[model samples]
Target: MSGLSAALLELRRTLDQEMFPLKVGDTASDRHALKELAGQLDDYLLPRLAALDAPLLAVVGGSTGAGKSTLVNSLVGAEVTEAGVLRPTTLAPTLVVHPADAGWFSGTRVLPGLPRSTGGGRAEAGTLRLVTAETVPSGLALLDAPDIDSVVKANRDLAAQLLAAADLWLFCTTAARYADDVPWGFLRRARDRSTALAVILQRVPAEASGPVGRDLRRLLEENGLGPVPLFEIPELRLPENGALLPETAAGPVRRWLEELSADARTRAAVVHRTLAGSIDSLDARVRGLADSVERQRLGARELADLAESAYTAGLTAFDDGMRDGSLLRSEVLARWQDFVGTGDLMRGLESRVGRLRDRVVAAFTGRPLAERELTAAMANGVEALIGAVADGAAERTVDAWLATPAGRALLEDEDVAQAGRLGRASPRLQAGAERAVREWQGFVLDLVRREGASRRGAARAASFGVNGLGLLLMVGVFASTGGLSGLEIGIAGGTGVVGQKLLEAVFGDQAVRRLTGEARSDLAERVRVLLAQDRGRFTVLLSPTLEADPGRLRAVAGTIRAHRGELSGGGAK
Candidate 1:
């Protein structure tokens, strides 16, 4: 493929992948614009550029009961398509081409997304009916599109798609409804895209034709559509068959189409005009879509940041609880005091360190009742702290997300909304916290065993057993008075002193300090992992938006803009 084709293809791929799932910044309109742009790429721009020599498709579209089908029939001089009193006369789009030009419309050359049908019966929804007519000009095909203002949403959507695919639009509107907003909307879009177009003012009395035509022409000029060809089909009775309008009524349009089609230069000029305009219009439309994608990306990042902040706060709270000696309370305090004989032994411990070492070593050899209780109490305290922090982070994230429209939409998603899962900690968080605490305890025990492996007190460590030493280390971590102030220091200070002295009895004062720092760091890392797992619940909801790369979209648009000459040259070929 050429560079321009490759760039356009990349643009299509980017648009296809962009979800705009987050309900951020006019998302509904952005999504609609995205769909329209993609549809035009598939149904018109790409295909037309690829086969510029193919017959021009002039889609006849307008408001409901505007006589679009009748115009197509009259122009072709045959009832190749159905026309009736039904609100939406055309259930499916019908394409009429000369027998020689049938090959162009028979396959997937244009409007490739819609299914093709050749059967005589009414075409089903989303199916295009192909009819061969000798009356149609050789280089032109007339497509009778469904009503642009049909009550059926599918019909209206199909109408817009068909019109976008046309090299020329023969927009038909009755004189009475010429000023309606719906038809003007399509006309304005045609003007913006520079699509070759003609307007037919149907059902106009001869006397009223001058005034109505002038008014419609003025409105067209006001909307930047002054250059469009305007045709007035004066009110006239239908033939006995009622299948087509009188020849005089459609003669001017018929003659114009034949003249345009018979002259290859005129036909190619129209094709090139619409093709060039469509390609040129892509720059702005694609850029707008890129902006929407960027919004989705940024909105998702904001939500992820909220989740990160909440969990970071959770980790900080966990650290505070660990350092302030908050975990060494009630049962844990009683057990520690009992295990170390705190009241008297904790006194004057700075000067009595050598004498108390023997008592600490002997106390660990037996694994007393107080030691087991203290171990259990310490594990329970760590687990509780983890669970509380995890829950707080989850609640905080949900509360923050609810304040934003896009975030609230994600939280409302069925997957995230089951029993308010996103609003609180995961049900399995308690178990996960418990598992993390157990793993940290094991890690501390390993650290103690490794630290004691090459020390003079190795025998004392073995006698105390790795488990007993590990218990004292855990106490040292929770009993740290580094973050305490006022009463907290006094309450947790004694506990810290007792733990320090006990560990020093087996592994000198320096080893005790190193061991405590290592164990505390290990526990904090484990808690971080646990909190991260909980945070995943919110971030996962944003995965679709986060995964879309906005830079790629902008790059594609830039590529197209830089290589416009290449695309124009290719289309001209």
Candidate 2:
């Protein structure tokens, strides 16, 4: 009994070191493998400890024809069990339990996968029997488990499970089945778990005894099987084709069983040995499954990086669209040559209203050229400039993006369709230009017409002085710069410099020189206002975002500075 107690304590110690913190149930595939191993240990071991008030059990487990029933009958000193039965000797496990305890038998029927129980003598059909025996040792029980490698599938599974719950296992195998793969596979499983195991080499054939013993030892050593206590029972004499093992050598088998199950010390040792080893085995299986679970956790980081990559792609598409709108500058530029050219443009403009002050002084100057002629010329000139600029910029913009790898990659390599912003067909800019042209043109004309109507209010007023301040008085009519004809105004700012040319075309430069240079300064001032009013709206929209990252935004700022240079250049840069 002391040996049994010590063995059981040792088993508990082993379990604490290896599988104390077992977690079980409610996990998916890879995790479920670990969970199941832990569950088996808990289910088997926890119940045993809780039933400590019940007698200790030694579960005899082994493969078919290993003489397990023969060994059991020998230990009990009676022909109490059938052997070599075609129906299988132990269809259900028979328990030799303490007689007075009806507690273990009361609700045993509800237990899962276990067979039915009837009385204290025999377990019912489809169940293991619990029998009471007085000489069965105080606080001790023994189970004759089904053959682990039985032909019946359920029996095989039941045997393996019973092995897990066992406090002590009598591992019986004949010399013939000793090295069999299926039995050894279970042996290995038990070995890793440190299950308390005592091997029985039963019924050795006389001819192959010596060689087989050596081979078995060698195989056991290679597999890390412990120096488990071994009990060898020689083949006993029997009638040919007999139904039972002919009895002999019952003494040795009984002594070992008593050592394992009878006295308190030996029983405790058996208990300790079995449980400690089983915990170690359980830990290993669970740990292996845990490693697989960890590999899956690492995949989440990859998913996050993929999201950031998508954002970068979107920003790139937006940048390309901005560049596309820049091409409309080419539309504006197309008018550049024509607006800057030598023509009757200045002469014609001066002839219409160049002498407005003098004409007003002469009574009919208040009525200038009709709105239709002025409107027609301005529209034709702006269209020509826009068409020419749009054509030149279309191809160049694509090439510019292709000039460097970054820009080329932005234009040609990406999923541009996903970005959906257009570089070529940007209506914002065309709209901005077309819109600016219509807005400011109408504004200027309305100013001229209103002033014309005001003067007509006084039909007899002597002179219409072309006041340089007239441009300022015109601003009250419109809401935003989008209403301005900024494109034409931008092209004509250069033409504004040729005041001498304007005077010559209208009144002959010779005649103008005869008057004061002070008069020419007055003319220049009006032209300056015309130039400013034309460009005021477009300039306001071109500023940069203050919140953007400095290094990235620097390029946008650089583009703006270069376009500003466009205003400063004599058209070369």
Candidate 3:
């Protein structure tokens, strides 16, 4: 018994660890079932197993106005439970126990989730009101549950909970209401659970009782409930007090209860049958819930995959834009032309090699317009490229996500959709990109100063060398490769070579190549870092729907299978 209890406890613990929010489609039913299963385990199964000798509780439940409360009152031979013509006569559940069995229910031994109270006091409507009747047998108790199809939502829910906690269900319904769809639904569930149940066909006309009883039996047999007991209470004149006609009118049901309560072994068999059946049903129900969790995980992964593919395309597009010489056009082209005069400086550098510094300083000092414009054009080109890539990536990610079910759910929240627009870098991204560029430019300036350190006192190297050489290094980094025979290569490479020679005249060939290589590598690294940071915007948006680990669900299934014998009664506990 302890081992079975521990296994059931472990199952409840495993279920509690799951979060089955209805964010995923097709999950609401599974979520509701999961909650109900957990409640049954806590309120009934484990508690009942711990105290197998506890009194048997037979909950009388059925469709609205099906004479459930009336049947309960007559079974105990007293008005222990309220019965009247009000729409929902019993708003709260009333448990009718014998005087000797009062202590069993008053404590937190069963249905502990509901607070226990005595009758005729100011108890909340949700409380379980206990009523002791001497006519009721000591070894058994009867609970008058709310109408299964009550108009009030709370009453309807409470009815299902009470039924799930019952050792046996004395399902009561009228001749007129037995064939109703609602009552049959509960009957079908009871059949599936293999619960101990007996139908009480109440308020039947004497002339129609034979036909109605046969028809009800056929329906029960067809629905996998062939051998379940069926007793009839025909229409008869009630006493002035509105109680049942007499003990003879309630003959069969009263006799069954008396026999069930009198025989201790019979009562234990009923409890064992219901308890074992409920435990056996857990594997399928728990598997259903675990499958629902897996579906949620799959939905999340689908959304994440969409985001990943879209952003990866964006990254590819950005890399292509940088390598295809697209940034060398428009204002940037005009600035480079103005700075070096269509490659004239490279053509004359070898002829005027000795006087290079004097001419370079004079040209730079007299007109710094080309140099300033070139630096501005480079910054503008890089910024525009980055912004366009960011926007394209954001748009693609949003579109892909919108096409999916999970994505549509997320987009329903206007704020999440608004946050997904990545057309421009955020303030933080823009600041970081700009700072990286500025730092790379500083690295170039340092290289120039270091190369010119041999000629420390030279005025040209100190004044314009750092700024002029750094701008040339920026232009060189924009050139794709030195092997192209096209006009773009000449225009871009010509500007780069002019910078190379001027620096070589001041330093030497080896230092010039090494310095430019180092500076260009530094700039490339900075741009890559900035773009990677911008990619994080898409990742952040997709984080909520990421797939969770499925190992916990597998572990739960494994544990249930390991203890199947004890739970299913193949071996005694």
Give each model a TM-score: 0.91, 0.44, 0.76
TM-score of 3: 0.76
Give each model's whole-structure lDDT.
0.83, 0.47, 0.74
**Where does candidate 1 clash, by residue pair?**
none
Sort every candidate by lDDT, greatest first. Answer: 1, 3, 2
Compare the candidates by TM-score and give the number of the best one: 1
- The 10-residue segment with the lowest total lDDT in model 2: 471-480
lDDT by residue (207-240, candidate 3, tens digit) is 9989999999999999999899998888876765
The residue-by-residue lDDT of candidate 1 on 458-562, one tens digit each, is 987787788878887887888766665654465467556656776787789988888888888988998898899989878877888988886787788899878
lDDT of 2 by residue, 484-559 (tens): 3454443233223233333334334444353223322332233233323322221221111111122322332233
Return the top candidate by lDDT: 1
CA lDDT, candidate 2, residue 492:
35
Superposed model 3: Cα runs more than 4 Å off: 1-4, 17-25, 98-109, 112-118, 121-127, 130-135, 239-245, 325-387, 413-428, 431-474, 480-551, 567-573
Which residue segments of model 1 deviate by more than 4 Å?
239-242, 330-361, 368-377, 414-419, 480-495, 567-573
RMSD of 3: 5.8
